[model samples]
Target: MKAIRIYEFGEPEVMRIVQVERPVPAPDEILVKVYAASVNPADYIIRRGGNEALKPLLKLPMGLGIDGAGIVEEVGSEVTEFKKGDRVYGVPNYLDGSYTEYLAAKATQFALMPRSLSFNEAGSLPACARMAYNGMVEKAKVQPGHRVLVHGAAGGIGSLAVQFAKAYGAYVIGTASAHNADFLKQLGADEVIDYNTQKFEHVVSDIDVVFNATPTTTVDEALRLRSVPVLNEGGIFVCTHGVWPSELFKGLLAKKKATVSMAGVDVNHHKIFTEVAKLIDLGKVKAVVNKVYPWERAAQAHHDSETKHVRGKIVLQIYQED
Candidate 1:
């Protein structure tokens, strides 16, 4: 099988295509013939060796993707929810990455692809959608008439957060550059804040929720902190720092009297995707794919994700549905 591998970390160029023996499924696992995968900030962070500072050292020959959509080729003895030939999508245990031809993971990590979506659309859902769901529904519990603020609202997870907040009946305010204001409005944000010209905190305040969609490295403390006073009492602030909130960020939350929670997809990828699939099938949610690349260009996908300029999600087409 072919897979994207990183022997050492530095740049997108550090990722490469390599041939490896196909993995076998364990008793509770399923082997999938990958159809598509999405590029995430974590993929680039892993490729550039940034994770070493926070997590354990990256083992050499690591794979480079986290979430993917594919057809189940074989099911483990204990698997029951799906069978061979089922179209499935979710984040694989990417300790080895999902940028590959074949991946084997515990069957519980995947769910049937929403019938209303294509392989590319379902492929892009797992991580970004999960993050959005985590922030808007789980942490914020946004309800009808609530005010929700989504920072970096044109980006992948941010865009999804905007939609989910709106779907939950919240009045959503999304922050982005001027070019994305119209796009955010189309995604159902009640208001769009062009951070390039206007400060978000100045314009959006007394919110029920604030979802941070910026990468931890590029997050502006002043802009993000300004949101502290912008919240209603006990409002939730969700961070996508790619890790837990920093001690400093935590202290700000404490001082502001707003509780802070790091954004996270549910650990049970299957269950969450199943819920998201219901939204997809109901036409309440859609994957905000910005670009699609052929599978072989996994490196290029990583490069584009690092640019942080993409409006929504980026996907690598591993195969088309047959």
Candidate 2:
């Protein structure tokens, strides 16, 4: 099998396609032939190295993808939900390193691919979709009448968050560049605020749930969201990026009580992925793939995702859908 492995962490070029032994499934796992994989912010972050805090989440010389779509090549004896020929899409594991020709992981982290989508579209769903689901549905528990605000609403995870919140029956407000206003509207957002020309805080108020999908690790940006006055009482602030627990809420929580949650904990849970698949199948949500690249050029894929201006997800076709 072939995979993108890095001997040392640095730039995208450090990742090279190398020959590696095929992985075998565990008792509760399945082995999937990689058809397509998606590039994410985490792929580039881990490649650059030295966020030692994430060492437990990532291993050196491991594969470089978070999720993918493929046909089930083999399954473990303990797995009953999938078969050898099943068409599946899912995160190979909760941690990083899924960029490869073959991957093995617990069967619970995957679900049947939506009939309406191709391998490339299904491959784009798992990681980002699950992350969005967890943030909006699980953590925030957004309700029907709630007003939801999605920051970075044009990016991969943010786009999905907007749709999920809308599906949950909330009035979705997305903040993006003016160019993406129509794109977000098509995804069911009731309102789109252009972050460049207009301030989101001034444009919208009393949000019940604020989905912050910006991929930043700093506390600097999170501080500006002192949304005490902008959010209703008990509003939920779901931050997908790394956050310093105490610094985010110095004076913001004094007046109104709000829960500040950092997502990505159970993002790869099997049940959530299954639900995401169902949403896609019902046309309640759609995958947004901005670019597609051959798996061999994964380095370039990483470069594009790192740019952070990509409208949606970037996919890598490891094997063409035939």
lDDT tens readout by residue for model 2, 154-245:
99999999999988899999888899999999999999988779877777788898888866656335434544457788887787876445
lDDT of 1 at 30: 94
lDDT by residue for model 1 over 41-68, one digit each (tens)? 8888777775636357577868878898
**Model 2 segments beyond 4 Å from truth?**
56-59, 94-96, 219-224, 247-251
lDDT of 2 at 68: 91
In model 1, the runs with Cα more than 4 Å from the true position are 52-55, 243-252
Candidate 1 — what's its lDDT? 0.83
Clashing pairs in 1: none
Q: What local lDDT does model 1 show for residue 3?
A: 87
- What's the lDDT for all of these models? 0.83, 0.84
Where is model 1 poorest over a 10-residue stretch in terms of lDDT?
215-224
**Model 2 pairs in collision:** 63-97, 65-98, 65-99
